[model samples]
Target: MKRKCPKVKSLLLRLLLFRQTRPVFTEEEKTEFTRLYDRIIQDGGIAPYDSSYPKFRFLQYLSVTKPLLFHGSNYQGIEEFEPRRQTLFDGTYTDAVFSSADGIWPLFYAVLDRSGLTGNIRNGCIVSRRGERFYFFSLSVESEDRYPWTEGMIYVLPRDSFRQASEGKLYFDEWVSEKPVKPLFRLKVSPEDFVFLSRTTWHRSTEPLFKTYLLYKWRSKFGKRK
Candidate 1:
């Protein structure tokens, strides 16, 4: 018999120990979820859970490990929550796909299963010139702006602006541009919830006051994508 690695054994143990705090979705609840799911894709994002989400205990435990760091000067003031073993959050803008084959996979998989919906869980990738990818990562800010505990905000760019960037007509030297353009949307969320945005969406976060988790890119086949 082949012996399992230590990491695999630890993951399996965690999976068995972790338990869901809420009951699974009911048929009626699933229908309502479907309605909400439709609206999220149309708006280019969705929050699958609210502050009332009961899985915080397990998520918090999962976040105890050291976080991955982004060496880029642009990401200097940010503190990340991506664990060392998780390669998807390496801080590069590189494009790629990941599998739900690890222990962390169930964290997202449970969310998807709870939704009773089908879609591709596209992880982080390069923000394509033609607006072709979506991403996921959890982060917090270490700057003075976060004097008290306050959740950061996300500023989303309009599709047209994204197109301009894609076409090389515009450039974002920073995470966001102060050049006044109507915001496509703005979001403020807690780690208790998960959010997913579309390829055409351009976003940046304000100072995060505490450690947070981000799970994104539920690209539905019936929805839109590259």
Candidate 2:
């Protein structure tokens, strides 16, 4: 039997499992979100954009360099969780201000629901261990690049690429290099839109003005079961 190509496998998995949708934000709500986003940025809510090595503090339980691992298969198996990663990004709010439950949770959840993963909102974050996967959420703004007229560019490495990096098959740096990598997902997103991502999906944004609707980790429900 021929072995499946990793890039092809990744694309198939994304097509079968991943879902992306733009949430419907009312005119008034959009205005409010924009206002809040701007306030956060002015107060230094944005992070410095590093085209080379992009780092984001997603939550208190996540680590910038390490990948989260879980035991068991997605359908039926044992369950365990590593703590989430939390490192402050360049323009992110200080813990004191960011931890508040007021601003973005409601809006974010509304958008996440559009992507078909509904969960309770709590403490400015959401973690759902519905079964074998983890559902995480965060807020981000797009970045402004000075050269190449690149504004709000986000680079994402597929799950397979990340796996290679983790297993020493490929250096993480080379995997994330700016050179165009085929079968990769690249986009210029707007702050008005909410995006859902996977934890294993390596992604980087340019400056500040983007929103991260959700980050999930699990064998997608659509994956073939063993």
Candidate 3:
């Protein structure tokens, strides 16, 4: 029997592999960042719930660890819920991974089997250059419940201009003109569908909605090269 593809699923498969390459941060910087990260964990007072799983209680203990990154200063306009942090790579940033390692991309696999209702809101910006771009990919699987619309967007700017904006020094009047180009495409994944899409063409998410227990994973060269 031929399996049918959901609207979002089909679109994602077609776009996942396309990406624009850009300069990445140096290894030394990444190492230093990791070192600071460890100190944050220790000073933040994150108690060891189960030593077997060093990061088992991250989501439950995020408030104590929020000091590692500057508050609303370094990277502008990105918001993360408790238990999440902005991770710097090269010069770009993303939500930190709880347990990312070699051969493992940050992957979130959630099973929503409860009857109660819950949702997640994700908002952020994607900065790309004329020749530099980023690819944001996501895959979702649904159960009997329906899947919600997930929003994604992207913004492009001059290399020098982006640097200023990231440092919270960009004048609002000037930065407003640097909004991202309209998305190349948008689609919906359903219970019967498995979807994957890439924003490598310059896009970002604008408070997308996802049902509880949704399964998610983030894969990048950082995970592969390590």
Candidate 4:
């Protein structure tokens, strides 16, 4: 759906923005998340995210504070995860094993099109407790005409081994570990499963992905206040 919040212009409008970048879920979402979390905790057999050979869809045990954490990458079967200085186009963070509370937030990384002009990829994943939605729009809308589909995986690791290092105002889902840590398991995902291109309604944003990020952050932090 095309949702438009008040422009981030006036100081009063800015007051509507919340400091926390992580998504703030609803009460019903909280209850549903708890149920899904408990069920996933009890079940078994969740693994892999190859873009070319996409397998089972990733489950949404979507939560930000639970013991389970996720890390997305193009590689697979990561026996041990070590920390490093992650440099991205948006910004960079210190050396640490990074992960997220939202299960699908990592999928963007897992199945990213590692092409030459990847900075403009249309693929978008919104990290929130309520389903952690994925935003995929038309390739020929206003910018590039081609989008690539690549292979990737999501590593599921235990949270006890790491500490929450969300120092910035726009990455509350991120978690960091200083020492090497192994994942509990991995899930394979593909574009078909991750981005349901058929019936989903999507919103297009020409604004930089970072601003789109701040948009979500604003929703997460202040949307809950009455």
| TM-score of model 2 (CA atoms) | 0.21
RMSD of 4: 10.0
| Candidate 3 lDDT | 0.24
- lDDT for residue 114 in candidate 2, whole number 0-100: 23
| RMSD (Å) per prediction | 18.5, 20.1, 21.1, 10.0
What's model 1's overall lDDT? 0.27
Q: Ten-residue segment with the worst summed lDDT in candidate 4?
A: 1-10
Evaluate all candidate structures by whole-model CA lDDT and list the values in order. Answer: 0.27, 0.24, 0.24, 0.51
lDDT of 2 at 188: 32
Worst ten in a row by lDDT for model 3:
100-109
Q: What TM-score, computed on C-alpha atoms, does each candidate reach?
A: 0.26, 0.21, 0.19, 0.53
Give one digit per residue, the lDDT tens place, for model 2 in 37-80. Answer: 34533443132332221111121111122232111111111121
Q: What is the lDDT, from 0 to 100, of the residue 2 in candidate 2? A: 33
List residue ranges in candidate 4 displaced over 4 A: 1-59, 62-66, 88-92, 118-146, 167-171, 196-226
Quote model 1's TM-score: 0.26
Tens digits of per-residue lDDT, candidate 3, 1-226, equal 2233333433442243333233343455444435544554454322222222122122212212232111111112323213233434333444332221100011111111223324322212222332222223332222214443222211111122112323221111111112222211111112121112221111112223332101122233222210
